[model samples]
Target: MTMMSLSWSLVSIANKKQQQIRRFKITIHRLFGFAFLCSISFFLFSPKIPRSPNYHQFADMRNLLGVPNTLNVITNFPFLVVGVLGLILALEGGFFTISSQAEISTWILFYAGILGVAFGSVYYHMKPDNNRVLWDTLPMMVAYSSLFSSLVVERIGQRIGLGCMCALLFAAFTCIVYERIYDDIRLCLMFQLILPLAIAAVAYMYPSNYTHSTYWFSSIGIYLLAKLEAVSDKKLYRANNYVISGHSLEHVCLALIPFLLSVMLICRERKFKRLGDLKDQL
Candidate 1:
């Protein structure tokens, strides 16, 4: 073939390949969107989950230094420390350069929520009642929703991310309200389950803009460990000779998540200058 014809053939092949990649990315986006919708539908249709009568009981009841559930309650102090430190860092512009004001605000909220968890959880463990449980779980929902928003902002558009953040916060509060009025926790539980899945899916489907995306995965791993610890609370307490419970360690693991995320923000540099770069390239 002539040089001109060969060049044209090569260009055509490249164009086809580009189109295929676009189609694949679009397909993945649609799949994630479908999964999100299904999660919402399930939350709307599922029966209300009643609070267990035994939910207030914890394996570690040892009073230490005049505090009940001392380890579980005190281990949460790291959350407050991390949260306040994160907020200060954000306020002082300690994160990677190019983070916008809105992004900083989201970080602040996430940290503040962590701080609230510290106080609220301490109060809940003091009494172990449903009313106090609201205080504990409400702040957690805030932290979870803000983290979701932060990830969305990093991987998607800022406007879209902010909108999703607002929606998620509203959903989170609604769960609390629904539980208070109806004494059911289905929506709250669903929110907890769905948000992590959404975060994971977004991380998987979208290209990372920062160098330390692996930190997100690490945070998720830590979160899963916390959940496992929480579920195996009694077993872990017994195994440890009643010195500390899995629930307490769960708090410690959870506290690490925000700290790791802050480290990511502080240490990682951007791979892209704009959202368009993510779409047009990776």
Candidate 2:
């Protein structure tokens, strides 16, 4: 072939390769999303593990009549259902894809659950008459919020959710510091170190999109912030030793995985963009 024909052939081949790589990534994301949904559903409702006595006792706060826990569960129930369904829809994007409008509609329902959790927690806390209601429901709210943001929200919505998540981490961090200063380091370490690391692990394990890296970033920031606070306060020694208060190596592992994955993802995205630019040149 002439030089010109050879060059054109190679360019066409490269473009085709980029398109195939993009499709493969999309397929992997969808399959992983479905698998993740199944695992999370199991974690939430599995019968093998014993239920927390506190969770049941809290449920019994009142009769099935307008009890807060019941009400809380019912009112916020749609989010859970939609969350599961969204994962299915996300999976369908792998096969019989829905229209973009349907996907957007599903996303709206999905993010509603996320924002509800943030707002719901504030509501739950303000009612001192129902501390049990607040405490029992808050964890679910936080969990669903994190999962919803990670799995559902898109470009703009993802950024908004990230801002909210950072606010939560900052609030948690501030509380930990204040508690450490006036009360004790124990509370701070638990809230700051343990909680962040746990969050990092959970977020890392979740099958999320490119924009959702904020969740991972926030998780790491929370840990890094806690570590800084501990060192500044001369509590690193306390954090590393002792049976109860020490920051374990396990926590370090949790933060590291997600942080490393975040780096890997950034590199991959840049590479994808470079390929797209080359395609445009053709």
In terms of lDDT, the best-performing candidate is: 1
lDDT tens string, model 2, 1-282?
455765686687567655644554564467558645755685466533322333233211222464543333343344344334443444445322222343334333334443444345335523423333334234433443343333323222344345545544454556444543554333333333334443454455443324435645654665475455423332443454422211222223323433343343334232123344555765
**lDDT values for all models:** 0.81, 0.41
Runs of candidate 2 with Cα error greater than 4 angstroms are 1-110, 129-199, 202-215, 223-278
Task: Give the number of the best model, judged by TM-score.
Answer: 1
The estimated TM-scores of all candidates read 0.83, 0.28
lDDT of 1 by residue, 93-187 (tens): 75544367668767778888998999999999988988889999999999988888887676665776687789888989998999999999877
Determine which window of 10 residues in candidate 2 has minimal summed lDDT: 242-251
Q: Which residue pairs show backbone clashes in model 2?
A: none
RMSD from true fold, candidate 2: 16.1
Clashing residue pairs, backbone N/CA/C < 3 A, model 1: none
Indicate the TM-score of model 2.
0.28
TM-score, model 1 to reference: 0.83
